[model samples]
Target: MSKVSAFLRKKPLIASLMILLLVLTAGCSGSNNASQNTGKNQVVKGGTFVYGRPAPVTSFDEYSEITSNNAFAIDKVFEPLVAFNKDGKIGNWLAKSHSISKDGLTYTFVLRDGLKFSNGTDVTAKDAAFSIQQHLIDKGPLAISAQVASIKAKDNKTLVITLKEPYTPFLSELANFSNGILPNNFGGVSEKQFFKKPIGTGPFVVQKWDPAGDLTFVKNKYYWQKGKPYIDKLVYKLIEDDSQAINQLKAGEVNAIESLPLENANELKQNAGTGVLTSGSWSIEQLFFNTLDKHFSDVHVRRALALAIDRPALTKALTFGYAEPANSLLPPAILYNTNKTIKALNFDTNAAKKELAKSAYPHGFSTNLLIASGNSTTAHLAQILQQAGKTIGININIESIELASFRDRFFAYNFSTMINGGQADYPDADSILAFQTDPKGFSKSYWTHYTNNNVTKLLYEGQKTPDGPARAKIYANLQQILADEVPYIPLYYPDVLIGVRSSVKGLVVLPNGSVRFDSVQITK
Candidate 1:
């Protein structure tokens, strides 16, 4: 059984209590809406909104060190220094204004005066600097602070950051939740148990969290925003099954869904009067091969495998024709990506056979493809690849396991090949850089155990330089290297398909690919 299932089984009574609370809360929220008053098509102030998420958050307090779906979910309750605006521009949130030095190695931020955390503690420059320090010590995802020479508080109002090298993506890192400013003097839990209770400087406060089912958040009375967060509370339900999630939306049990399956996208689009469907580019879903594996270690075998698949057909079959065939690691329209020189993977069965003959396995060879359980999308892609491989006399053995187990397996290099979904948490080439080499002074996610020194040198150069043109040239060259190596075959860029209730308005679809719930208002 999965870790989550085992946890629920351990605390059956708590699970039962949460179920009872859910029933009562749902009943109250539903009935309370009838008598509550809100603007005609504008936001309401009293009602609570129920939302459906694919999986429950594993940790709420383990900020800066871990990345998960719940990271975004919890961020709603905790604010960030900068946010991706509707037009994909980085806008000021906690930091009222900011300025960069002429050399591009220093940044000075003017905090929004009179800001306070949900705990009523005043937010200061020390809070912002300390948060960044915390991430560097833990070697978190936003660990750019090591290169950061110093972060000094000019006063209670101004915070300055000085980097050893020019780093343009520092702004993008600040936009992440890890850099979110919390009260500097706050201390309560051990490092390991910190996630049990998380305090933030956002509009909502976590009132209750039932690990097995849902987490509840109530509006902070002292929120910094002016007349915002129309809803009184937010509830996130853990509904792994798509059918159950869709049923809950149709039944008005949940106002919004985390994601809508591509098969249901058209149906939801047709019902515009009651709800709407929105989509945008997510990260690249690619086929990654273990470079260290004996069979795939051969470049000829890797090239043959890449040439064998019919990517167009696979894209159509897996995404229901709602995705674009990927040509590079970074999304096409994402900021700072200029890899237009790269070309898509062309299907060449005859060429594939020629390359296969050149390899030791002239007839064919079998390998296992690892897939995440409960994710039918990855399973479908695996099946398509299996069929395509058979045409070239290559046999594929597909294996499926839940995300938790899959995480351990993928990290341990337990599989020869795998299909995985990578989300660009922030919009930049640096987001895709995680999957590349183990660059010095950087966090590594090169799970395929692939590395190239030339690519590594370019990545480091691009990271330290602040010039856009120079960085673009380096990234393009890096992508070209990957294309030639075929370490990970670019599959397709999947759409962030979503279903929204018609009663909800002001819910702008962000360019970075996440739901903007703060602006969302119920109009029923």
Candidate 2:
């Protein structure tokens, strides 16, 4: 699972109980019209908005660490040529306009005139081309760099990108926050110096950073967007404990917070001074099997375990009815997930037993299930699997460890099976699928270490095909193949929940789970 998911999954019951109390208090106060009240307020500037994050940002550099925890902060300092709006549609941001060739292999972008970085340096087409080439050289967390054959600056205002093949979701891939443009001389800077003093063409500039504590930003005077970033200052307070963050929100110490405990989210919806914003994200929590493990080597054993879990019940229990059961790795919000006919592996213990009987160990086998410690939801999931395993004659041993230890074992390919969370960097299926199935270029991010020739071929073909019925068919077949193979069992997709003070207007939670504060204003 992604670090954000793990952070949010902690202290669910306590958060729920706290929310119940807050809801009762809100009921006795007055009518609930936080949304209407917010709309009635006028946009005012010159206030510091304090936001809360459950964890500290691992790195300031976008290419070094692109986790959701740091995305909102990074976006304030850097911008992609194209970006996803609040509605999840791709729109021009730094670029004035863009076009794709008829062959679908070449993409051209025209830079807006007089763009300047936070450091007062000119941002030209050369910076765009250099940023992409730097990502390719560094082989960052994102997989989009793998498809680029070449990137060249036609002139000061024009940039061209040539792909190895026709990639239909190329535009969406560029919209990813990880693909944010950097300064031309960024490659020559040392990592430590860059983190301490980062430069970008974004709305805000880093004023102060307290390790493992908080990050403060001041408005960028050279920001290209005129009169934007109405808020003069943005503060991200790092509080690893969810309960403390919720308390801070209630006390008005913070203006906004995300990944609230489900129960707290429920109660905050009725609170007059608070507004709860919920939106679907591309994040998916799933069980990934290590194909290198002996027990999971057999398809029958893998399929049996997949069929044994009741996804609908698990989803309801974990999310408190706020999230829907995920049938595939790609959520329905993405463009490639157009196929609705493919059936998910249903819950059937009898069928599970029968499938296990076909495996080498007809009597079933024992294996360790790795999960992160401090996550109540994952602990509950592990217990559910343990009980269900007994019915199918399979034995499961749950091993819960700290997040650091879990990552160590997971990326080293030392686990049998693990329940984790992952989010597509963009809306494209290739963003996630390529890393999972690409045998030749799989990074440490692909913890499952799954390798299948057929799956790899399908992923490659899907990337080469343009967007249409043919491309949809390729992805449809690919999902079916992975479903049958049982490399990663789809669990559920959680809703992105944000709690904001009613006075905070125009705060939008993007589908990718990043907060857009360009139009946000704090009303008195």
Candidate 3:
């Protein structure tokens, strides 16, 4: 076994041991029911909440380049300039108001005074400017936002941002926790130190992180919100296995978990009193054919491969009908042209054989299917593809590697065919395009290595325009181009499932396709 795989294998046992100790010390039930029952109707005071999370965090530094789980965890401890309102519109959070210049080059931000960091430092425009510049300094993962040309502090309560160009999606970018404002005294830290010891300005303070077990957060007494964050402490336990996570929730060891398996949903629903469940949009699995590869270089071969596999069957078997079969490159639920000509290629084994015969090899050639290791869903999907490919005389050898290894290999164009799953970074269609089309020509980052001149132009135009209607049209055209290019074959869009405790209330879904835990409160 590889080092990562070995570590992952050992991690669960360690977590279990830690959990056992917590159970022994804290008692079987996590509830302080005596206090809770008496004060149930009164102002929310405090109670420690232990919860289960589905994935392993790649990093804890809110500003560092890391995985999605890293950002999700950071959101709990960081404050952003603006937050998504109920209508999914960007509303003021740290900034009281903001305006873009007529030319769209400069953005002026009016700050809310008297806001203090967790350390009691007054949040000022200089702090905002420094936080923005930190991204450009290669100090942390926040370096992704180096696209900003200048961030100037107009005054103590006012800030002005000058962009390299008219970035239409800048607001959506700001919504990312990586852009969350840090205290002025917060020096840019190394990537290693950043994750190990993270400090942020948010509603909670990290009390402890037992690396092998749980991360505990106490409610920030100095939180900006008035008489809020009713819960005393939030405890996040790292339970790697779905079965174990569900078991903990049922046993009342943990309060909630994300991405619950659909197969177990019915069983959990049967015990509705103990487990409360909800679903939202989060992730999609896709088949990425390396266009740089000689075999997939042909459009007909790509189309034929698309036709051979049965997405409906795969979805039913893997996702228990909880996911929508996605044939189009653009997700069906996206705000773009819903009636666009993008449609699923039908499952036809005969057609696939005919297409293969027309190619240089009358018999289909063998290829390796690379997948994220230790992921059951990807393995299941690969098995389905292998069975379907056999019928079409296309032999597929499946290879499962750890995510970190697979990402490095795939980005280097070392893998040809892979079952790649992409989670939507933002609710926007532009986020989808960043993965497929490569106008820069065979990018190591773009696994598809897809090059389309027309699509590239449309993407540029879309990024430049601030008008929503015009932007939609641009994305609509790009989606059609994507359908024609076929860099990625869509598989399924899985509905995000979350299991929460009965007493937990106000657990609303964030627009970024994650749960807003800050808004959650555990009632008596």
- Against the reference, the lDDT scores of all candidates come to 0.64, 0.72, 0.63
Model 1, residue pairs in steric clash:
373-401
Q: Which candidate would rank higher by TM-score, 1 or 3?
A: 1
Q: What is the lDDT of candidate 1?
A: 0.64
Q: What is the TM-score of each candidate against the true structure?
A: 0.88, 0.88, 0.84
State the RMSD for candidate 2.
6.1
Error of 1 at 390 (Å): 1.4
List model 2 lDDT by residue over 1-524, tens digit each.
12225521110000001011110111111122122233666446667878888666656666655456666677788899998665566778899999989888889999988899888889999999988787677765554544788899999989999988777668877887667887886846875687578888888899998756788989888989887788788889986566787778777888888667665676677666776767766566778788888888788998998889998888887788667788776666666663256776789988898999999988987889998765456778888878877788889999998765776687689899888766655556676666556766534326566777777788888877766688778888888888888788888877667877777767777655677877777766
The Cα error of candidate 3 at residue 416, in Å, is: 3.0
Worst 10 residues of 1 by lDDT: 8-17
Q: Which of the predicted structures, 2 or 3, would earn the higher lDDT when compared with the native? A: 2
Question: What would the per-residue lDDT of candidate 3 be over residues 316-342, giving only the tens digit for each residue?
Answer: 888875677776654454455332366
How many collisions between residues are there in candidate 3? 2
* Per-residue accuracy of model 1 over 1-524 as CA lDDT, tens digit each: 00011110000000001000000001212324332345564344557777787667666653543344556555666677776554445678888999889888888998897888777778888888776666666664444532788888899878898988787677766775555666553445565554566667777788888866798888777778866666777888888777787777776778777656667766665654335444455356777788778878777777787888887778887787667777676666565543356854468999888888888888988889888766567667788889878878889999987766776786577889887755555445665564344534232334567777888788778777664577778888887777777788888866655566666655555433445556555655
Point out the higher-scoring one by lDDT: 1 or 3: 1
lDDT of 3 at 163: 86
